[model samples]
Target: MVSIIGHHLINKEEGYQILLYLDPQLIEVADEFDESFQNKEDLRQVVNSYVKNRLPDLKVTVIRVVLGSLVIASIPLLPGTEIKDLDSSQELNLKTEVKEVFENTPQEIEKDLLLVNKNNSLADNYTPLNLIVPEVPFIFKGFHEKKLMAAKAATALEELFAAAKANNIELYAVSGYRSYQRQEVIFKSQVEKHGLLQANQISARPGESEHQTGLAMDVTSPQVKFKLVQEFGVTKEGQWLKEHAAGFGFIIRYPEGKDAVTGYQYEPWHIRYVGQEIAQKIASQDLTLEEYLA
Candidate 1:
């Protein structure tokens, strides 16, 4: 067990706990191989050797157990499977397999880390449950449907606003949830003015908008006249939000330099709620929502 730790086979305390909860027979095998292993790679080789010799039928499962759940789940496709080998029918079958695996994995599915972009659109009838207005300052006065966000996101936004206020930086919520119909109108208007190519870069097309998810909010400050603009990114409020929004479960949905990946122009004012843990990780890694989810 100590040798395993020394070899970095399990770096986290949670991994050790998981090992203990796993089959005791496997633990004995790990103990026997511990002294012989020099590092994680060596241990992996030994495990592969064992699987080849004694546990041929359980190779994938055993490899996954040893490597940790994240590695097992995060792979876009199955191990040893090539994208080129997949025909249309085989591709569908692979997608079904991956979807089934993700569905069965609660930790993966319950994170609310949904990805919404041009390629992945929500249904026109889709509406988030538990929509509520966040108790935060807004650019516009009075209640409006656009002020509403998913309950958890609303709560997080309130906390985020309070924190910003405490720093003497007043943050205002500009927009939140938008219905599919509202998105269609917004997109069409942008297209009429800016042309389709420019509109597609700046505005989401109907169901493709993150505003429909009720988990995204456009935040602004008085520095920018409470407007969402690229110049806002240079403001103190924007800098502060970029530095600390993750603390309250938010992330800059489309960061600068990630437009190609996110399928939209950089939106410094747009923040998406994906909870604290994930938000922190995404921010720390400097990843766009598309990259984080991918």
Candidate 2:
């Protein structure tokens, strides 16, 4: 028996497609993954390695399959490459134009690049524009406000999660787009549990939270039991975020040893999307958002 898994690199309606056919023994392993995957080069390498190790003598032919009603594009095949098309309706028209794939423009610089911190508090009634839920796995189920983020940031986040999946990394969203009132409740609770001083170090006041901007997200992995703890920074998923997040328009909001600059303890799980350009600059320079803006 073989298990087949499929994913679209772009929006569901278009882009390159990935289909994984795993033997029965590997089915259980593949079952653990979410429905979609990305990063064509990395996944292709992984599949090739697996096929080689499993059956060295087997001959493999790489051919693209066009499905019925599916407008497929960006197969990565060379020009004039012929593919097997199976259309349910009429004859399938083949187009071999090699256009760029996954070309998402970076989010607008002004709003998405907002700097939020203890000193830079938002207005009490401030709410971000275009809040939407990203199509990534979350630690909790059911409709909730924390699942929301600005539309542009959410799209970047989806790409980030897809890349993580392609690299065999599992990351889950824990929190996003919290309101000022919610922040107040959390801050008060933290203060009650661990004194006002400790709360100031760990929790943000109502108006002084990055979550209010809808550009920040807290992510975790199964290895850390989906908890927001400093230990998560050492896990493989967290390590991957540190190395690659900036490439996708995100950054570790509070890095270790920058507590003074950030006004908060190191929170490796918290990633803030500041668009790719600024994110990369801040990450490369090892500067906090405050420092970068300054």
Q: Quick one: best lDDT, which candidate?
A: 2
Q: What C-alpha lDDT values do all the predictions have?
A: 0.65, 0.67
Candidate 1 residue spans exceeding 4 A from truth: 1-111
User: Superposing all C-alpha atoms, what RMSD in Å does each candidate have to the true structure?
Assistant: 14.7, 20.6
Q: Write the per-residue lDDT of candidate 2 for residues 1-294, one digit (tens) a residue.
A: 222121111212322232222222332333223224333334334344433332233222232211222222122333322222211221212322333322331111236666666534554556777899999999989999999999999999999999999999999999999998899899999999999999999999777788988999999999999999999999999999999999999999999999989999999999999889999999999998877766
The lDDT of model 1 is 0.65
TM-score of 1: 0.65
Which residue pairs of candidate 1 clash?
none
Best by TM-score: 1
